[model samples]
Target: MFKNIYFVCFILILSSCGKDPLPKPSGELRLEYPAHKYQSFNSDCAYSFDYSTFAEMQNAKQSCWFYINYPKMKAKIFLTYFPIHNDFALHVKEAEKLVYEHTIKASSIDTKSFSYPEKKVYGNFYELQGPTASNVQFYVTDSTKHFVTANLYFNSRPKPDSLAPAVEYIKKDMLHLIDTFKWK
Candidate 1:
């Protein structure tokens, strides 16, 4: 009985050596981005703007369309060009449609209108908050002949909390593009 009692005591001592279980404190993810460097994007298209050197500009399937690809962030900004033929309102409607399509999944949506009458650039920027397929979208035009629409999409599932940094980074770049936009 003494031997059995000693055996139980040893087992108890060994098991008690471990620290008490504790729950880990939750933490937010930290993401880092490089300094922003931009260069003017020139093409046969009628409009021009500056884009980040961190991204690659590729020609899209359609004429005058382009994709600014951020391989590091696994995201892409798709830009589509349309020569307005008395359809400026139609193009604006289409851009609003694309942004509103995510309403079902988006927690909230904000719209900002911008115009550079000197450059003849006018547009609305839409920022959607949530796990939607797109977080930022916009449309720009000269209100006479040229129209362009853009959407920012990520390759992976969007957890707004996790993607907030990347979204803000790209959103700033997009805003820069809009600010420098000019219709030629």
Candidate 2:
């Protein structure tokens, strides 16, 4: 009886080890964002631009500051408008400083400048990579009278991989905003 029991146990163990366990097929979460369609954002403030129809704009304390909320993605792009007021250098410096502040955790920061001399719109667009708090920052100015800065933030934990799709979608929206931007 003991020999029969041992033989049965051995067979069971051998059967369980038959094939090599395959590693879980390495995979990543696939996320899809909405296709962007934009509309004009006209305000009583110093500047105006085109924003994604997907986002909802909310008023802030000051007339010149507003939030472009992406409720679905749990993110918002904060826009602040400042009058140049013979202090253009100070405004530009502050914008650069704000971008550099994320350097501690940023893997890389890429800046691209856009100029529309015909429309008198000029500024710098910054894309900050890594686990930084703000993934994108930009400042557009008419150089003498208007300086508008925008930055993006997510409501949840800053996971670069998880937020990549949302960031890319918003980035395109922002670029379109810059291209159509004009002083009001």
Candidate 3:
């Protein structure tokens, strides 16, 4: 009787010592991103933009913009180009029109303007605004030659706050491409 009681006690004790599994560290999770790939179309058009290999590029059937996909990240980047006459004010207005039409509006808009003295990636000069109230937009022109603009959107599942970092990283890449941008 004592032996059976001891066995039951031992079993109970062992069962009572149960432990929960350790929680995973969020930082240890790995994510896969696509390799960088680029394609160049003829420069006979007003402008050209190069996209990362990870992005799938397609023209919007309804608009004049190229839709770039970052499928792994469930995000998108936008590119649009237009020819400008001699009017700087008119070009700025056109840029505003593009932004208003496409970008999502947050509670507040933050706008910063930049002027590059020399060509960086795309042409002789460029202007852009970052962390805007709506979407992202940048315009490039070589005082006398061409005008081009790019807008970025995070479409798949947009979490503006979560996407800000990735968006900024891609923006730098875009800037590099723009800085070295040349029209052939």
- Highest lDDT model number: 1
Candidate 2 lDDT for residue 48: 82
Taken over the whole model, the C-alpha lDDT of each candidate is 0.94, 0.92, 0.57
Residue-level lDDT of model 2, residues 89-154, one tens digit each, is 999999999999999999999999888999999899999999999999999998989888999999
In model 1, which runs have C-alpha deviations exceeding 4 angstroms? 1-29
Off by over 4 Å in 2: 1-29
lDDT computed for candidate 1: 0.94
Local error of candidate 1 at residue 94 (angstroms): 0.7
Per-residue lDDT for 13-92 in model 3, tens only? 99988688799765523343444456654344655556566667777663445676667666666566655567756776
Highest TM-score model number:
2
**Tens digits of lDDT, candidate 1, 127-172:** 9998999999999999999999999999989889888999999999
Ranking by lDDT: 1, 2, 3
Residue pairs that clash (backbone atoms under 3 angstroms), model 2 = none
Q: Lowest-lDDT window of 10 residues in candidate 3?
A: 120-129
